[model samples]
Target: MPGATSPLPDLSRPDVGAALFSTWSVGTPERQRATVDALAASWNGRSWPTPELLSQNVYVGTDGDTLMHHSQWTSEEAYLTFVRAHRQARVDEIDAAVPGIERNGIANYRRYRGFDTRTEGDPRVPGCIVAIKADFDDPDPDLRRKWIDLVIEALETDPAPSPGLISADFHLIVSGARHLANNRVEVLNYAQWTSEEAYDAAIAADDPTPEWERVRHFPGFKGTTAKRYRFERSFVRP
Candidate 1:
């Protein structure tokens, strides 16, 4: 087990039941890039699974020129350190890097726990969603406002028929990071689904509507893509 490492720090097995799904808006391309680099560098110092299997992607929404920068981390402690270490000062720095960018939208954050299966027992796959991060972008502030309103409508009005999604949380990358780097990264959305199937199906719905495309795939966003793999969780951590 030369390169082998636990998905969860200090935990014997993967905690399949829990996970983290988060979305963020990092202002602009330059700001988002800075945030991404800062995050990678920060996580490099933390102990966790190999980075090779990790996934990251960026998407741009047409609704208001919003961009979503997404990443799936492999460690909970690494994620925690990321949050606690980077706050308001980080926020200020991202703003300083971009200059005069004001967003009226609030970011979301969540930590999902309790699984139907145990990651410790399963050899196929281990651990829950270590972390999910996304960022939004818009060319016009007014459009951003309108887009937010539309997003709220979709989240509430057009709820999924059989949503596998569970609890969701919210947060904004504030400022003044003594532990982590200085960069503003907002936590826009987070949720826990019952299973990977439910998660995939929830997102798999194909709607011809333009709005639907905006949610699934936006144009302004940019980043490395994701290559999926299938796994089953048989282990549990107590």
Candidate 2:
């Protein structure tokens, strides 16, 4: 993993209670990553809450407008504290450094399962990731758990039956959005594949059991959306 980012926080720690995912944007991938790199360096260990776990400065691809910053914190309060401080001042520095870049979205999620804290290097997905965020009414706890399991199976097995997957992470919303706000995605599913082309081919394969059919029309299924992210900068705790 040459050019790999370093000093990433470990996600496996029990103390790492929450994750903050913020998406920002710049006109080009080069500027998007460069600006965020500068912003991250500016706050490098200088802010509150400290983001003690890992942070992904993911902006390596040249297609999309949104670049994501992923960080893990010791607790929800610590996350909020960092958010407060970031909103108060650090954003100005970002704006000054990258005049056109803007924050596209922000989410604070309770890490539910499969964050893969065991690994000691940058995340190994060679191509890109498919991130799904969804909202649903909790009608049955048992059934919900079952659905989660089944979906995880899809991600792990990759309904496409390919070995291109590096990893997958799933989570449920703690309190990120509201139903009325129209952005209330309560559950999340993430999958990594060799390339965007591979993902597209898999989705088009007409296979129903592993990924699409098992979850999309699930018993308690409600609504969801997807975003694509290129493998960017990732870190591991020393």
Candidate 3:
């Protein structure tokens, strides 16, 4: 795991056209560390032949039983090509190192919008990352777009949003192929905060925010789930 402490991905990077998000249930804190170590070893031990694989980041969940892998790619086509050629062998290598990882299915997405709240003079590094999942009852991509618009409008118009929110990047799950279709659509919010306490304070004060209330009750909005994590390690293409 040497040289594994790299910087997080630039969510607003124009060259990054697609992303893949997946999680694994490792069952214990010890296993969580072991899993991340195994992944870093696998990624850094050899030369990555696929130029399209821009970066891969690993996060250890605060709850002690989960690990999230967020990988950036040049395009979905490149990802598919990599999957066809290299995915399984890599999976086998990792499995041999750390067995019984209950992998959640990977979700594909494209960054649709992003907002950065930090000013020019700010020098704080984000200590917490929040992954928020907004689910809709309908599969229509238009509904997903409308809901995100509402969220952006609410945040933009709010007069006194909680401080310490570094940035929020919204992603829309890609849809089209039969294998990717579902009855529900999901929008993911990848948010960075100065600290876990800052995020907790915002959640405690959520009830009085009129802007948030409007977005919460928007039509077709089903429900949301969120989890917090600290960046564990990352690997970028050499």
Candidate 4:
């Protein structure tokens, strides 16, 4: 986000510049479950350019009724260009899907920071996810470097907070635009583990690794909202 982090990963390449973060609110618990599952099925069937790098659909609900889509593209400019050419057909398809559901706004993110541990994306896999979103203090270069290094180290050390981690992806928002519903992120991270049993073992150990612990105490971030979602996962990566 802040001029890219030193040597970036494949996900951080310039061609991989645009990301879609969206939330859909389906009224009531009953409808929420059905609608989310239906939408996931419908989305998997839709015709559109393949998401260039990544695509994810996650469920997070205290009441068991929420869904979010995280998708990546070549760039914001690339996405804008494609939308201009396909806006009408896309709208028509969406209109048909719109029976009694309300569509929430979307946000575009320009920078991607991924910390690889296990594999990247697959919704069928079962895992425990730790998702954090917050506004960064826009620190000087030194602190930025420090933060990034800690994130990388956190997942690599043996005896990590959770063993058998699959992967971790941290994304930052360089664009100023964002969704209005309690969602504005200078940074967002998603970390996945192999299973709840694996995660429990990490926490049960005598000493836990310092990766996530250290980052949590860093002073450069504020207004952080952190959540843990069980059975949450990223959609199949393209």
* Full candidate order by TM-score, most accurate first: 3, 2, 4, 1
* Each model's Cα RMSD: 13.7, 5.1, 2.0, 7.6
By summed lDDT, the worst window of 10 consecutive residues in model 1 runs over 229-238
* TM-score winner: 3
Which portions of model 3 miss their true places by more than 4 Å? 1-5, 178-183
The 10-residue segment with the lowest total lDDT in model 2: 176-185
lDDT per residue for candidate 1 within 160-186, as digits (tens), equals 443454423332333233322323332
lDDT winner between 2 and 3, please give it. Answer: 3
Query: In angstroms, how far off is 82's CA in candidate 2?
Result: 2.5
lDDT of 3 at 75: 87
Q: Over the stretch 114-185, how does candidate 4's per-residue lDDT look in tens digits?
A: 665443464434355655666667635355456756767766675534445666677655444433233443
Q: How does each model score on lDDT?
A: 0.37, 0.59, 0.84, 0.56
Residue-by-residue lDDT tens digits, candidate 3, 138-219: 8888878888887888877778787878889999988777323232489999999989999999887775467677778878
Q: Put down candidate 2 lDDT per residue, 15-114, tens digits, no spaces.
A: 6566666667677766866775766655553433253544444444335467766666666666566656665566677777778776666666654566
| TM-score per candidate, chains pooled | 0.32, 0.73, 0.93, 0.62
What is the overall TM-score of model 3 with all chains considered together?
0.93
State candidate 4's TM-score.
0.62
- Which of the numbered candidates is closest to the native, going by highest lDDT? 3
